[model samples]
Target: MAPSKTVAPANASAANVLSSVVNSYIDKTPQRTKLIDAFLGFLVLTGVLQFVYCVVAGNYPFNAFLAGFSATVGQFVLTVSLRMQSNTENKGAFEAVSPERAFADYIFGSLILHFFCINFIN
Candidate 1:
């Protein structure tokens, strides 16, 4: 008869490490960082939806589609930068830039991006 096989030890070890990392993240991550992550998720969803719409229906006004999609992508990038700069773990790297400054930069960059996107759409 063939020998019975059991779960691999390596697979079990990998699962344990993954579980611990996830638990640590849930317990240690700050609320503000969570909020940024939520926004990033929203941006990704929005961009995906817009692309789907363009694909299913024809992009009659291709310029408008371009503007909307670009805005989502640009905003996502800006938000990620803000999150990185504001994170406590990265404080040493961004010593001179305070969280407030990073947020202000994000807002300013978003406004500029929107303005250009709108102009392109029209």
Candidate 2:
């Protein structure tokens, strides 16, 4: 009789290990947290720079450009707000705002952007 072969699931174990590593690092290091903050800030700045570049380029549909830009920027700002509230080191002034509310704000801003876009597109 031949012996049966056995395969082990690796992804679950890897995820568990990764989660533990992240949790331990966050618990232990302030530097990691600050680096994360700086990276996010840089992302926001890059977004703003792109928007400025779009403005300087002068596309045919300014409204459409603005609509897309607003949506992107609004979502970014909303997420940043969420992180601010969730982060242990910094207590955001708008900490009371929940994810749902921030999401709603993003959606509302998107709607307003599109509203202006359609009229301006024509």
Q: Give one digit per residue, the lDDT tens place, for model 2 in 8-62.
A: 6798889889999989877875664566567567768867876887868876767
Which one wins on lDDT? Answer: 1
Per-residue lDDT tens digits for candidate 1, residues 1-116, read 99998767998989999999989988999999999999999999999999999999989999999999999999999999999999999999999999989999999999999999
Positional deviation of residue 15's Cα in model 2 after best superposition, in angstroms: 39
Which 10 consecutive residues of model 2 have the lowest summed lDDT? 82-91
Please give the RMSD of candidate 1 to the true structure. 3.4
Give the poorly placed runs of model 2, Cα more than 4 Å off. 1-39, 42-46, 90-122
Clashing pairs in 2: none
Task: Output the lDDT of residue 30, model 2.
Answer: 67
TM-score of candidate 2 on Cα atoms, chains taken together? 0.39
Cα lDDT of candidate 1 equals 0.96
TM-score of each: 0.87, 0.39
